[model samples]
Target: MSSRDPAPTVSADEGVPAAAGEPSSAAPVEPAPVDVPAPPEPHRSRAAARTWALPVGVGVLVAALFTLYSLAQWRAYVVKSWDLGIFTQLAQRYAALEAPVVHIKGPEYNLLGDHFHPLLVLLGPVYAAFPDAFTLLVVQNVLFGVAAAVVTWAAVPLLGRVVGALVGVAFGLSWGLQHAVDAQFHEIAFAVPLLAISLAAALRERWRTAAVAAALLVLVKEDLGLTTAVLGVVLAWRARRPALLWLTAWGVGGFLVATRVVLPLLNPDGEWAYGSRLDLVAALSDPVGLYDPAKGYTLWLLVVVTGAIALRSPFVLVAGPTLAWRFLSEESGYWAPTWHYSAVLLPVAYLAMLDGIDRARRGRVRWLRRYSRYAPVVGLTASLMLLPQLPLWQLTNPGLHFAGLRAQAARDAMAVVPDGAVVETDVGLMSYLVGRTDVYYLGNDNPVPEYLLIDRQGGGVPQEWGDVLQVAQILHPGVPFEVLHARDGYEVARPLED
Candidate 1:
């Protein structure tokens, strides 16, 4: 077996190297296996980056566009009405350190009496800084519109990024757009955004953020605070321990601040009392109830019921609690049933509807799966068919069209009057216009003026207007009255001496 000199050649079977120049059947093989390092996981890191970035970018972009659109529309429509005058007068009053006492005119405008909402009073500072009503409108509209979009975006779960983005867009187009762009009511626009932020905070389990949002809600309208507090408690219970503690602290702090410092300061008169008139039962039972079916009751009810069910979702506990409170409280017009209230709930409702559809798809029940598949189609068809019939809904409300016409009439009537001349109006909006803060509001049982401007095209005379006219007839017995202008359900009457 030995073939070479120096060192004898080893046998291949022995696992030794053969001598140089001699070929062996088997070469030295690798040593017994040992541990080695693994390759880097770059793919996993890349996937995680994608998971978060997509949702965030989409959410921001959608919100920005929606807000811009609404603000532009508000700028166009707001100046055409006399609401600008009310805002302007109030701003001027605040600047002059004059705080007028708000009387109990009815459930609708009672909140106007005492400056109970310090948040609204902040408008004083805004007006003071800008001194331009149009500028203020643009800024407020843009801010709230963006808030609506962002909050709606936050409503969708990260798992359903597409649905979430759609929800933001849909809500902005629906409730947010209607109020911010069409009606241009500040209360509605602002509430929508606050509700959105509240939704986002609840989902994140950030107690401080939720509490702050709830606090802002209270500022918008008082009763919303109670609803928000109850929701906060529910969220805290779901989160447990440290989170609960923070939530409790926030709840307590907010309650104290709102009740002690803010409410008392703003509502000095404490005359914005709550009563049976504004009760939820009354709002529901009244023939002239706020929720008219022709306008959009099915959509509204669907939103409420679905949100309640969505509360049971394991993943949406935070949003669920807050939404539940909104649903339950909104039943009462006094609590939060105004058109603005809808803005807060729109995103939540959309989220709930999506959840219902998803649940139906995953259910064991065959009927449910079939129903879920057809539900969207059915809803869409119904909405389109019913949408054309919506104009009838506006007619049911006798006062809505009249109110718009009256505002227009007030603007035109004010154009001819001297700056300091007082013009009595059934409502206060006209007084605010034309820089005539001293005008006697026909409300509060005040007597009519020698001059009476009645906007006939506006609609049936307001009870207060009738009262003013009755007094004018008695006081100025044979005075000649001239009709200065007339159009669109409106007429202006001024007294002339023979």
Candidate 2:
């Protein structure tokens, strides 16, 4: 025991103990010193703890790079979509502990109606501290980084630290994740890391860890419940554990509860909004119609990036629900690999590759076992080749370092509008204004804001500063409105007092 720790009043050995005032009967006896051998377990544990430093270090490095890229894009006004603004507004409401009434979607539209993501509320405390759109962006970047780290850590035991680290680099530079970064912040940002942890645990047959992680996906987004069901199938089939069959029930039941019950109740229309959007019957009837070149390309890319070796593992089955819903959806964005749609697929692909390789190494097939050793090299090569065409390539360009005229114009327009003022806006300045001002999308259903903020280049309402007056006239005809700041397609206007 350390000197600071209190000593036991009595000796551990009964014979060695005696009252302080009362003398021991057998002469003066000295307590024998015990030589406790230092357990090798603790030393091994410390060494094992030291072993994980590589994965943690690698994840931090990759996350830092991603965070830098995301922040740079924000600084340069690289508005991919209005998603960043929408998520920011959701965070704002959650921070205030208010109902998620996002005006940017429509007048007091509870975003839960559009999509079920109570998990986004976790960002409430974060937004409470920073209260900016970039806060969400940063959180997403960090999650992606964490996913990469988990992937690396998983590979470490099977592939060793160096190859595992390489796998992480490939994951960081993968198309799905890079595209997610390009698409801006999304609710699925939470899913990427969770799935990574789940898939990694599945690789080692940690059923409890895998199922628990998959269970959480339903909260991140409603449809992930089906994804959880698929995970249960994988676990049941691979582990041969009948008890795990309950996950399928949990998943399907949760999806039903979230969609039919929770979503409709929270919805502004008192109905499930996206229930009818899936056209699976039409897709199945005319199989030719389901043949989207983009969809085909995304599917091919999923396996090819893993050297097509990931197909050997059943863990890839976890991705079936996500791909099924995407291809089956009527939304064109869902069919494409771009945007934030495919980020969930990347981790699955990499994990499948590792699982496939690890399993192959032990199999009877000689050629396959020999080939598995070189698979990581192939995956790394593919990722590097594709890096030039993806978003991370922006890091190599010296031109991306500085903010351009459009960014300056956005700042100028926002500066003219005072903080806390209600402003109706387009996607261009929506993210910029949502943090400090009340922002509503330019739509007839939403209430008229005190200030009209539009970008002639922003689309929907206006694309340039010069177009603000026309939008004001269209919305409020015969009501004189003063153009407050109109420059470089970013404009702000307020209705004149009578």
Candidate 3:
């Protein structure tokens, strides 16, 4: 994910401990004594270049494909939620080197209070150069792409070139990633690539790289601190890195401060709103009730996607925090394999599949070895078969990038509102205008906007508020508004006095 950081080196086999008689678990990181000796220096350089090229090429391709749909969504105005607008506004503030004040959230709301993501400040420069919501989507896809490349890098030595590249492509196109790309830009996008690099580095026994990646994850999202802690625990137990103990402490401490101090202090409510989700006492009292069918279905899909192979590696424990919080939370949205929720788990599952393959190949059980031998193909096949119904399917359509009549109408509505004016908007037209306007959600309480843009049939509009005038009156009680333009259920308005 780093411009300076080279991709994971494709040397050494990531192997498990040889049955009870094997020389220690660390025996695997070393290349098996090559009796054939080293290749000629000239040839070795070429071979190394080619070896690295394959994964790099695949990563770039995967990233392009993922970005394809992202651009399509942005171009077509296929916003799934207000999150796109929220991030766009946040990025604009950061670009101007201002506090993360997001008017889409509210006129005075600092987004750090919504979630402690100081890492997003990095987006300021990127957004400054590109200055569009699509930039966020591209950044997100490229991160996912890097993860895919890392997975391919780790898999190549384990599974060989053909199957390894297939697995990498599969990981990129996996249901979880596709769903996330389909859902659009989010802060969680950063976590996906970091998890992949950390797991891949761990697989190759690169403890330093693993530590760095895991540390970066804590900054991506507050909840991911637990994931980092769990990764450290697994690494410490797997090997004797004394530094890992400190890594564990770093993770635990980061989570505590992010939730208990940073988030609450930034939040207007003076509390991390999501802190309520961590009620261990409630979870303990009714552990059985937490076993809802939707959660089970989510678990089932995770297993099925990996063909049950991801369960073999203890590194899969990295997904524990991700799963634990989801199951612990009352939000049913978290329990399902929908949106960007499960994006972090994709890299963990695919890399763990590689780890699982190692253990399976070494196990005494013949059936297990055979299953491990084919797990990559099994996963790839499963992903390919499901691709048609996934977001990538849009890539095959003729109109994939077309901004339809409704999209044009939205662009028009947003065009009517001058840049930098305070504007209240519903979901459909909100993100399009956010790049320039001080956008507020239409129904929310805030300083009255100079303009109002509404999509009468927009996803978030209250169904009972059918009349356009009625909506404006509710937004600014005593003020009168004149409809400047209305087309295809999209409306742009201004105060009668303006």
For model 1, how does the per-residue alpha-carbon lDDT over 1-498 read when each residue is reduced to its tens digit? 456557764433464556788767655654555556898667977876764464455545544554454344332222333444454555555655556332222212323443234465666666666664454455455555466455444544532565455444444445324333433335444555665665566556666665576556656654455545555665566456445444445545655565555555445355333222244564457645454443355345434434333433432432343343343333443233233434555544544455556666788888876766555444334334443333223324435432343445556765655555545544333423324434444333433344454443332345453443343554455655666655444355667665
Q: What lDDT does the true structure give each of the candidates?
A: 0.48, 0.85, 0.84
Worst 10 residues of 2 by lDDT: 457-466
Worst-scoring 10-residue span by lDDT in model 3: 9-18
**Model 3 alpha-carbon drift over 4 Å, by segment:** 1-48, 398-403
Which digits, one per residue and each the tens of the lDDT, describe model 3 over residues 1-498?
A: 989998885445554445676666443455665566776566777887877798888889988988877777777777789998899888999999999988777668899998978899989999999998878889888888888888999999999999889889888888899889888889988999899998898889898898899889989999898898898888887767766977778888899999999989989889998888678788879978889898897787777767788898897899999999988988888988879998999998988888899888998889989899777777777777888877788678837445554877777777788888988888887777878778898756877678877787764788687656778888778988888988888877778874
Put the candidates in lDDT order, highest first. Answer: 2, 3, 1
List the candidates' TM-scores in order: 0.58, 0.90, 0.88
Estimate, for each residue in 259-287, the C-alpha lDDT of model 2 and write its tens digit: 99999998888888888888788879987
* Model 1 poorest ten-residue lDDT run: 101-110
Q: Could you report the Cα RMSD, in angstroms, for every candidate shown?
A: 11.5, 6.0, 13.7
State the lDDT at 395 in candidate 2: 76
After the best TM-score superposition of candidate 2, give how far the Cα of residue 162 lies from its true spot, in angstroms.
1.3
Model 1: residue 395 alpha-carbon error in angstroms: 18
Best by the lDDT measure: 2
Error of 2 at 137 (Å): 0.6
